[model samples]
Target: MRFSATALLALPLLAAAAESPYEQYKAKFQSFLSNFGVAGPAADKASAPATPSISTGKAKKKVTEPKPIHTLTLDNWKDTLYAPVKAEATQPEEWLVLVSGRNKTCYSHCLRIEAAFNESATKFAAMPQSPSLGYVNCDDQPVLCNSWSAGTGNLWIFEMLPAPAPVDIHYKRLNLTTVTSQDIVDAYTGRPDIQWRKFEGYFHPIDGFFAKYGLSVPLGYFFWALGAIPSWAMMLVVSFMTRTMMNRRMGDANRQGNAGGGAAPRAAPPGDGRS
Candidate 1:
């Protein structure tokens, strides 16, 4: 009878544990997968069309594609910036500008702008900056910024300068600096030396974040967070100090003015009033 009672009491505790938050999360994730038409837990082990099965006479198993992952680096910096050139009378063409911080291991990939290209007499320009896309236009140039995800990476391509009235743009990559202005003119009938400029942008330092947790966060996140600190704090501090100094100076000036005998005594202001 004692054993039976203890067993019955333990059953309720086990049931409570089974209904924990972790189990709830598992249930919710399963439902999410179910909505996508997969057979919950057995989706990986089942012989379904989406899950490819391989058999070697002795055993059969389902195969799943590997998941893609982004690398977290402390020293790598892949940030980039772009600045486009404005048109001038002497230089009547636009140029694409690019500045990128290099990564120690990974090469910066798919670095390009997305803009319109056509035959025109005036210079047209489009630029892209890290965290934003910037552009400069001399004439009423048409430019587009399109970023499409191609598989695991992004695709960015655009035009810098429009071609002459007779010629049209055939390729998207504008390698004008490498080629002479006359070459560009010959390639597109009267277009001048419209080139793409590139430079280095701000890069996040590696191992900068580990200091936050006492475990030493990566430098990249640390520098990034430090850079994002509010500028208003510094401005407010400086303004406060300035105001304090100005007040002290004004107080000293007031003391000096009082000591300088600037105020005359009301001598006999009104002998006529009351002696």
Candidate 2:
């Protein structure tokens, strides 16, 4: 009778937990997601309640799974892509792209964007399981700049996990309120929800090719010059050989004409008859 009553008492709790929403359970991480603008209003509303709680009969050892293949932001985003990381690896590796130039041509907004990227990148690079950071100087290397779909004076974030792993890499292009130091860092780390645009890389387009291969305009020219130098050299050699052959022919003709036109043939015949 006691066991029957106990089972009856636990029935409502089980139903409540089973009926609760999934986001309500991940309440701990929701605030951070909201701040980063990753999870939007629906998530914001769902995070009030903690994760579902169901009675398991006996105490189970708690095990937390390491988050893997994260692009696990607000769930809906502008652009998302995936690549595989190698099997044997050491630490987390990621990238953030700053699509701007350093020359005199770089505008005021470009400089500001770079500053924000640099500031956040530095801090991110130093953290535990931190990611490596890099950028492009569009003035110096324009070929690859178009892939991120960000024009001069904007930023693009990339998370590269090159080492071997069971999961594929994820890339998220996020949007935010403004460009400021640590703004990108915050964007990457996860914060309040913000409106973002997706990056569309195209292979048919010039910029798309560069983005797909991570190449640049200057690099293309360098490759062209490599092949061109050899072609030009071959042409010069052929021209020189033709000139030498023509000069030899002209010298031979001049000698033959001098011998034919000279009075030497008559004198030689007279001397030989006298001998």
Candidate 3:
């Protein structure tokens, strides 16, 4: 039969020759659905949760703070203990701070003592560690001084006047009649080390010129002397001494002529008086 192009195309699709058109159409529809994933229920239920439920055996932990340590003192503070703290000032109201051990720090302790140790006119003596590692200010009302170290522990004793010679303040053997450990700790409204005892009897602060040699005094002297000499004057003195030493070693016999001494006296002219 005579067929137009459209009629021929539609006739074959509708008639189906070697294979069934319906079956081909079904296969193609399934393929398209699979490519886009619209064909079946979503892949297995989103994988089961790795852990269905958490265990309840573990519990939260609590934190604990460190306990304060005991305060150690020297048995014979005046003799056994030797340090720069003795050079500190002495006053009934003044306080002394002692810190030791490499990791030990007395900043807070010193501040608290300063509040109780000072009077309206009290003053703080210069400490060896001052102007560098640390310093004290009696005028600050709450004067704070501290010692930090990683090697040997330092004993610091605060008094109303500067420390005595040999420069050591031992708290252990104070005449336990006046200032006891409890007295001091109690005054500060805190509990210090357990070995507190009241020092009784006459406790006089020692004084002597040797006390001047304490850390602060000598340090000051060194700096003062260092500043007194002018650069040129120091250079001249050093040069002169060096030359003197060198001349003595080299045995410069001619150097005497160049020096201020006059030339050897000429032999008296043969008896001028004879003429």
lDDT of 3 by residue, 145-194 (tens): 11111112122343333433222233322222243333443333321453
Best by lDDT: 2
Location of the lowest summed lDDT over 10 successive residues in candidate 2: 72-81
- Those runs of model 3 whose alpha carbons end farther than 4 Å from true positions after fitting are 1-93, 96-157, 161-209, 212-223, 230-232, 252-275
lDDT for position 82 in model 1: 14
> How well is each residue in 39-126 modelled by candidate 1, as lDDT tens digits?
6765464665575676767755544332211121222211221123223223222222221212211133312211111211112211
| 159-236: candidate 2 lDDT, tens digit per residue | 434422322222334232367766666666662254344444442212245634645444555543443467779799
Question: Candidate 2 versus the native: TM-score?
Answer: 0.35
| lDDT (CA) per prediction | 0.34, 0.51, 0.37
Which prediction has more favorable lDDT, 1 or 3? Answer: 3
**TM agreement with the true structure for every prediction:** 0.21, 0.35, 0.21
